[model samples]
Target: MRFAISIPQFYADGEFDPAAFRAYFARAEALGCYESAWAQEMTLSASPQLSPLEAMTYAAACTSTLRLGCVVFVTTLHSPVHLAKSLATLDQLSGGRLEVGVGTGGPQRPFAAFGVDRSRYLARFTEGLALTKALWTRDSVTFDGEFWQLKDARMEPKPAQKPYPRLWFGASGDGALRRAVRLGDGFFGAGSSSTAAFAAQVSVVREALAAAGRPAAEFPIAKRIYIGIDSDAARARQRVNAALAGIYGRRVPAIEEAAVAGTVADCVAAARAVAAAGAELILFTPLYEVPEHAGQIAAEIIPQLG
Candidate 1:
């Protein structure tokens, strides 16, 4: 199974130091612990945040072999032509090591701010995805669609990767799952997802792939997982809970249950279970209190698995 690390660039307290983040990536690269690194996207949110694309672009410059990705980009917020060109530029700058993850977007306020009709978000998302993919593959294309229309439009500087970089879709509910299966090259789900829920989602993706006459192996499956590693399981739990509570403005009971905690062996076993459940890659999202826990995982859990 492939392993990756996700940095939470958002925080409720304290300023984010770019130098420290660069150091973190340096350490992670030196250890050879991760195949890729990813960042979360949140626009117009009530917290200190860094732009995911900008951070990933910086990371691409800092590391040589590690692939960089944004967990999910809100496609409904931007015009397809502008987004396609921007992503193509990012792919070229990153040396073809970019994976674009798209979502329909959530929350009414952000859509309102962007002047996107909340009721037509799904339709816009679908049309935008088609347009972006077309732009990546073809030279000049004309399309007439419900949300957008173009006449002989062309996008220059195609992605460095052949055909285009991989596209992953983030899904939560049944409708979202169907949409992802219909268009996405891969699937993404929340870190707090249960084993049964993950299994169901995987089954849906696999069946969809088969129905579409595509090989299952053609697409990679990635899931975000919250992790807190310490010698004491209780201490690990406490650290994760504190971070979640601080961010959400209330205690989150699900955080304690969803997080992978305890000793190195315990965390490894949990990772194995996730792999067995069909996740090819797990993006571990750790709380700020124990950011070094990733180092511990690299030193201990990875060795055991290897």
Candidate 2:
């Protein structure tokens, strides 16, 4: 399975330091240990954070080889036409190394703050995805949808990649899984999901692929996992839990339940389980306090998988 790292845009102190984050990505690429680097999107959070798009743009500029991705952009917050254009621009600028992942906006505050009708988020997400795809592949597009209307409008300087950059969906429910199979190139399982829960969602996605007459191999699967590795398993777990409490203002149940933390052997075992469950890519989000722990994972745990 491919391995990637996620950089938190906000720190425990509720401040963001873009330059420091960019330096981390540079170091990750230099280590020759990551396949991609992704950013998270949290629209109306209680913390200070850099926007996902801005973070991605910065990472794209700093790294030449590591694929740049958005873990998932909230689709219901912006016009698809505008978002498509912005993403296409990034794709062009990044030399075709952009992977776009999107989800229906969550957290009522963001939707309410942005003046988006929360009731129609799902419909808007579907319509926006359809429009974005058309804009990328077709020379021109005209569509009349419930939320948007376009008249022979065309987006230029199409993404460097053919059709468009790879599109992934971050989904949590059965309906979202079905929609992802129908519309996306891949699905990103929720970060907090259990192994059993991930297995169920993967089954749903595969079934949708089958019903659509699409080969399962054509669609990749990705999962975000919190990982902490140290010589002492108990210490590792404590560190991860501490980080979670700092970031989320609550305690994570345990490494076994909410994260992958332990000695190197234990972490490898956890990753192996996820791979066995059919996850093609595993994106690691190191606990907040131990962001640098990712480098240790790159050096110690990832090599064992091969």
Candidate 3:
């Protein structure tokens, strides 16, 4: 199993220290402990978080070998053309070390706040995905869809990765999992999901791939896991629950239960369960004490995982 880490995004106003951030990536890359670094996007949330793309761009500049990505952009809320252009630029800027993750952002999201019609958001998401791929792969695109239209529109300096960077779909539902099999290069399970939930999603993904005649080896499956390592399991659990509550704007018992906490052994057991759930690439996200979490995971956790 491959291991990844989350790029910290929860910094308050004037709290971001560029030097510290650079050191984090540099150390991570130097140790070769992480294969990729990911960010999460949550716009209009009560918590303070950086924009995923911007955070990713900063990360790209800090580490040469570590692939940078956003776990899932709420694509339904974005303009397809603009999103495509931005990703293509980021791919070039990162020297092709870019992974794109997109999703519908769920039913609870305030779609109207983003000027999206709740009923048609799914159509917008599907069509937008198609448009983005066309822009990345073709010299010029011409298309007429229910939500958008383009005529001989050209996007220059196509993504640094030939045929575009890997597109990962963030999905939990069976229908969405099947769609990922047809449209995305990989399936990414949410950090908020439990190991059991992720396992069920993986089963659906595998079944969908088999039905589509797609090779399982070609489609990577991954999950982002919220983790905290502390000698006192109770303290770790308390801290994790508090941090997640702050980030999610409410306390969720399921998410708290899903998080990995406690001593190194405890974390290892949790991560092992996730691996058994079918995460080819597991993104270990430490919610609090980000720097210390990185060091501990690199020195203690990664060695045990293999």
Q: Highest lDDT, which number?
A: 3
Predicted candidate 2 versus true structure: per-residue lDDT over 1-306, tens digit per residue: 798988557655645666777778778888887899888887655555678898889888888999989878888888898999999999999999999898885544357777788888888888988998889999989999998898999889898999888889998789889988888899987677777788899999988999999988889999888877778889998887776665555665743475888988998898888777778999988875545677887888789886
Candidate lDDT (C-alpha), each: 0.80, 0.82, 0.93
Q: Cα miss at 301, model 1 (Å)?
A: 1.7
Q: How far does residue 99 in candidate 1 sit from its true spot (Å)?
A: 0.9
| Model 1: residues with Cα > 4 Å off, grouped in runs | 11-14, 106-110, 289-291
**Alpha carbon lDDT of residue 181, candidate 3?**
94
Q: How many residue pairs in model 2 have overlapping backbones?
A: 0
For candidate 3, write residues 1-306 as lDDT tens digits.
899999989989999999999999988898787999999999987789999999999999998999999989999999999999999999999999999999999888899888899989889999999999999998889999998999999999899999999999999889999999989999999999999999999999999999999999999999998998899999999999999999999999998988888999999988989999899999999999998898899899889989
lDDT agreement of model 2 with the native: 0.82
Number of the predicted model whose TM-score against the real structure is largest: 3
Name model 2 segments beyond 4 Å from true.
12-19, 106-110, 249-256, 289-291
